[model samples]
Target: MTYPRTRGLPTTRRTGQAPRAGTGSGFLFVMATLSCVIALAGTYYFFVRTTTGQYIDESALVEAATLNGPAERASTQFLDWLPVISVVIAAVVVLFVTIMRRRWKAAGIALVACVAANLATQLLKDWFPDRPFRGVQTIELNSLPSGHTTLAASAAAAVFLVVSPRWRPLAGFLGGTFAVAAGVSTLVNQWHRPADVVAAFLVVGAVMLPAGWLVLRTGNRWNVQDGRGDHWASSRLWALLSAMAGIASAAVAVYSLIRIAPGFGQENSTTNYFWAGVSLIVIAGYLATVAATWLFGVSARRRHAL
Candidate 1:
């Protein structure tokens, strides 16, 4: 069945009118500035005071770090490989936005946002330079804003702009999970305090959300087609397949986690197995949903061509 494309209410665009300043770009700029200011202010508060003003604290970090050998190893592995995963996720968002929305502007804006966030984090770190590692007591430089969290949030915003609105909830959930994991890992590893992680989340969110909103608004104005037509069977099938793949990947990841860190739970060996099984099943369902949607789009296109 042919599905009618939904169009938004038309707005006037005069030739002499300055090209509509990208809402996403403008919003990103504002957020980046705000995050930088906050990071700087927090750094000053921690360093400038005569007495050691602990602006951020991570009491739980000590507990998290004292995990059993297996759990500690697992966490280490997760942290070590996190940067690679983040880069891959970012690449996916850029590619999806470029292909689906045909919005080079939005992609560029997202890239800029990522860069700005990273720079801001780095600058803040430099400003609040942590003392050289002198054992557990050594305080590290300004770790107020987490670079990993920033990357995750920016990437998530980019993906949200490219994907259909129906997928927003899933995108947001995945993004939030990544951001939280980044923050938690840093805290547990004693690389950053809890306040730093919290600040990072707030800073990233403040920038990303507005940037995404702008991208959506500007993208709507451009009249770009995402190529995913509403062919019920095809769409459903694609979503199912994509979701299945995602689930499978997630399962593999979880299994690897368990194998690498078997001592995570109590002596009851069955608990780990149970949780792994549950995780696999849940991830599989999510993957299946995504696969079905993607496959359905492919099917629709093929049929249209025929």
Candidate 2:
């Protein structure tokens, strides 16, 4: 079965050379991955090793505890089944797409990245030392790079990489929402701090970005995209919506932190930092989705791809 090649990407003119798509994307992927790793280390250093960082992080979790009501129970229930939920949904969708599109190699690539991301998270958790007693009575269980969040984010990422550009916008949106919701749930249930979720997002991005570069290279024949307006799922509107949401959430995070800064050490938090942490997660997850979507869309175009 010959895969339909789109007239989207350019081939070598009269040279009979194979099209080189997104070589620049490869470099960008490396930079993005390095950035993620550095950010993870930074997040750990500040949130787990510093007094103020621990205090603020712990403060958010503490404030979250004060909201003792149905939300707590709901988050608990959601987290309890998150592992299974992530596996089943990701497996079903990815498997269906793989079989339908016959994207065996692409599926294999995505699977490796997914497994690698999750495995890296676990290794980091074990390798990292316990949180130091930073003047705060914090739990020193090495729970950085939360496993639940890694699972959810990687699962969503795998689906995002598997689908064609035609379906990416919708897939990215839904997948991002799932990841953000999962992260917020962990915080609500007090299972992991905000930094843990953020770290998980970074890990997934680090792994998935390289895998996406490979997908574009190996599956260039099928990765063709006309334009953002070509399909509803491929619309820039989806990206705009995600960006708008990200910007709004970022503002909320900044505002929350600013409001709590003047009296940070002295005053006990009244759900300020908690919302801030949640805001950070939302922005990170949503913005990453938007970035990845834009990268693929641009890379598939003439300037980046051959």
Query: What would the per-residue lDDT of candidate 1 be over residues 42-108, giving only the tens digit for each residue?
Result: 6446433323334113223343445457655665677787878877887877787688868786777
Q: Rate residue 174 of model 2 by lDDT.
A: 89
TM-score of 2: 0.91
Q: Which stretches in model 2 have alpha-carbon errors above 4 Å?
A: 1-18, 263-266, 303-305
Q: Compared with the true structure, what per-residue lDDT tens digits does model 2 show for residues 52-99?
A: 889878888888888789999999999999999999988998899899
All-Cα superposition RMSD per candidate: 11.7, 3.5
* CA error at residue 172 for candidate 1, angstroms: 0.8
Q: Itemize residue pairs with steric clashes in candidate 2.
A: 10-306
Residue 11 C-alpha lDDT in model 1: 27
Could you tell me which 10 consecutive residues in candidate 2 have the lowest summed lDDT? Answer: 1-10
For every model shown, what is its TM-score relative to the native structure? 0.55, 0.91
